[model samples]
Target: MMGTSGGSEEIIILSDDEDDKDTSCLIVEVEAVKKTVGVLPVSPQDEDLVVTFSRRPDVLPHARYDCPIHPFMPTDCERTAPMANNELICDQCFCYICDKLASLCGMWCCSGACHCNSHNKSDFWNDVRNTALLGELQRFNLTLSEVDHHLRNADTMLQSFRDELSALFSSIPLDQAMLPDYNINQQDLSSRYGPVLECVTLFLNKADKKNSRAAAIMHLGAAEEFMRHFQVLGFMGSSSAATTSETIIMLLHRVISSVQRRIVMGDITPLFMQKLQTFYQNRICFPADMRPLKNRFKCFIFGRNLSPVFCSLTIRPWQDVLLVSVLKGQNVSGFRKDKGKKDILFETISVVLLRTELLQLQSRYRELCRYLRVVLTDNTTLYQHLQDLIPFFKCKLGEFGSALESLFPPASPPASRFTPPIFLLYLRIFETATAPRLTVSQPEQLCFSGASWEPIKDAVPLKRSELVKFALKAQRCSLPVGSDPQCWASLLKVVCSPHGSPTALPVPSQQFLHESRDAVIDLLNQQGYNIQISRCFLKTYPDQALLLLVTGALGVRILQGSFSPALPVLHAYKDNLWAFQWLCEGMTSSEDRLKSFLKEITQESSNT
Candidate 1:
């Protein structure tokens, strides 16, 4: 210990302190630790019971039907019965005493023995695998297996039809070019010019069934399955807008291929769905109105059709979901190259989704409306609907947001193709809006003063640097368990101006950059947030005015103590590639000097 000018003994401690005894006295007397635990955050993950997967409960795909399946047993009803010597009060109710009974697909049995008591065998799945549609389905199965020989078989079969059409066309005499038909032609045509030129009509106009007939049939069938299965049935088009034969062929064939694969792969579960999310991040966003068929079919085989067009519409056939992609819009090509209006790929997906499947969700719009409290802006309403159905389209918000960072290069970015709908998606996933919603301080106390987070030392709202000080005061607060995590992501990304480097302010508008930056620092100081979250906020906003966020707010305080966590924050800001880098480096390095200068009136804490 050394003597101070004020006559109190001054103790000095080093990093290699040999004794823990005088260290606390020297440090605590010289400095105080300031930390702020901001709002409680919504934990990113919560433990959910691992779905002990069994066979899915039998219900329609969208219907929520839950049934617990047990191990398979013999077909003997008597042996499986829970009660011996069947003494049910009623035959329908197979209980020995109670009238209550259960039916496993209409076969009355003990609830204890019957696994699917809710179902009736008469419900038609009761029609075992080889039931009502068995024969036709067996034939349909041939479509998948005999696929290699399909076009060849079709070519031979169509030859007869081609010949039939040829003969029919030959019979129609041309009136325009002096071939008046009937009397003279009928009698002597074959003997005269008939044998030489033939009736010619069928030969010129009709397709020779031998070549294209088979392909046409298969294409038609595949197209039908895609439209019908996706619940897009009874769809009609005019002469000006026909779903082209080539397009139908592409969609149908691709689906035929995928259907078999999905079947072979067996049932999909949530666990399987989660696995798919990993790869989904990098998928190029297709345009809203994308017809992905042509894109899909270019490299594949030109195989013959499996089903006829008419039959394709009516049949319940498995087909590829990938075929349902939207056709790229011609308008997309017109985008100004440098524009970032929307992402091209997702634009296509959104448009196609809106036109196709999203229409169905409109019915569910009423349900979503109730959830939104009916006061939702049009944007919020769209957000809710998209959130629910996004999984079905293989669109996960987390994955999409994660992907957005990669797709956009640091420089020379492409036009943002996100329409309003897609933009809504971005907002929900990336950052939640805190606009117009007042966020009070932790412990959420309301004194005679307005908000707990209101001004402490300012006459007018504090200038950029000063606001950071008041926000720092909030660090002293202690909140109740499970408070909402104080938000930073949204406030940090506000971008200051409509367009500019984020650091270039819009006349320093209310200094959101400063406020948000300080808020993040406060969060870090209180041990209120994770390292990643603190980093994300700091990374997003690095203005010099916001430097205290890392240094004065967090780094300086941590440096004087034995805390190690704040050191990493130092390394992170070292690069200064973003706006706050320079300030971050300076602040962390100048820790002691800044700490003594900033907090002259230090209060000792009772709790560690």
Candidate 2:
């Protein structure tokens, strides 16, 4: 029995196997194996590695050598062996060094060596254990280093993918002139974007394999955002082409989504078309097998914001198909939940207004108001004048007018009237593409920064009202003098257009009026614009004449200059007529162009 050097346990070998019994013998076999395999040299620390084992003190004396009597010597030559007294018995003729089993053999000890050439037993035994442990540790470190390398590579790939995605978005062709010549081939787009998406998918797979929860979630979100850009591009394409059916468009979207799922879930071995075909067929039918896949796709696309998804899923497919079939000349159904034509018309107008009118007002008004506020607050004289034109209180008494009237009585002195110079400044700044910087006569001599209000003011206007009246009565079609601008400018155009029915506009009454007001308010809120001030103004002045006047003045300044003392304002009126005519010119042309495409589609479907 031998004890391990570390004192963990006693190794008792009762086997008849000679090679296994001796630790030195095992070490010799290991060295031979190393020579056969040709492994690299281990760490420098392993150079001194030694295997060690302890022997029982009681068995030390009984140690004996297994050597045959030399043929050259007489049979009388004695051998070392264990004695009946359990002790080593060596004859006088035998080598003294050979008598000690644990000692190094000398020249006289069995002709300088025993059966084993290794003379130092301690070094042999220690090396055996040390080499085994070192081999295992080397393997563990190798694996760890490989994983680290993989993660680093993935990070680099992710960054490259992000850069490519940015380039794709920034290069989108928005101009109509560029669209026909745009050279981003569909096939090339697919080829370029595929690898970028796959890199992200691969990173996600690796993260999942490593059980990195945070990394997996982050990559998943990034990939989703990446796909969102494509989705928006798809919408813009549909609007531009107007050839693809909604079904085909939706399926294409699903195809991309399906690719993401397959890649991330480790199932993307098939060809691209094969996967797309499978998803397309499966989605159109909604097979039981594909239900889970569809649900997962929805979950990823919408995350927890599932209102639209839930609504879409719950609605019957036949109903959607039926509505599409019927909408040759009619408005699209299944878009909004409203059942009445009047309500749907109002809702559609609300959506258009939010996107166009309210957005323009909120952005332009906020900027103009901020600068005006700073200017007015700094100079009381300017403030007093501006307040007179705008009225700090009220001009008339109505439902909510009495309170406003009390705040600013008509009988009071005219301290609030705006001077023509400052009023013209206010008008000209908004009218031009670039608002000029002002040096206000205040204590600080503040120089306000210029803002570009072109996006709002420079947009094409809808002039169907003038167009219709011009066709009906040529000489009488001029814009009325001293008239407030239309508040429902967009809707008025839609209703007055040749294609639109005059009856679509709701009759003016308490109910219809209240509904229109609510619709406007709701649209403003939905667009993330604060309508509290607008709402109060609308309620206080139900005619919307004041609101119209303010916007009309801005519009008129864009065409005809107001009376500011600045040179820019003085020169603006000469250019205003041309500018207004140009802005209004596109309205009819754009409507006609859009209608051409829409009518083609509707007519073809209706005929079918």
User: Per-candidate TM vs. native?
Assistant: 0.19, 0.16
State the number of backbone clashes in model 2: 12
In the order shown, the candidates' Cα RMSDs to the true structure are: 34.7, 33.8
lDDT against the true structure, each candidate: 0.31, 0.32
Segments in model 2 whose C-alpha atoms lie over 4 Å from true places: 1-293, 296-320, 330-567, 575-608
Clashes of each: 44, 12
Report the lDDT tens digits of candidate 2 across residue range 1-608: 44557535445555556677565433211122243666887998898888798773332242223222211221122224222322222332232234334333343324323312221244542343233223322211222222344334444545555676667565654342123424445554445444545554555555444323223222433444454554555432333232222222243343333333333333222332242334333323332322454433232221223211210111121123333332232333323444553222211111121222222234333222222222212224534433332211111101122212222343432322223232223223222213332222221221233522332233222233222221112111112211212212322233221233332222234453344444443433332111123345346433332222222333332333222222222123232233223323323435554344345535555665
Candidate No. with top lDDT: 2
Prediction 1 global C-alpha lDDT: 0.31
Residue 119 lDDT, candidate 2, scale 0-100:
17
The number of the candidate with the highest TM-score is 1
Residue lDDT tens for model 1, 211-244 = 3323333322323323332222111121111222
lDDT for predicted candidate 2 compared with the true structure = 0.32
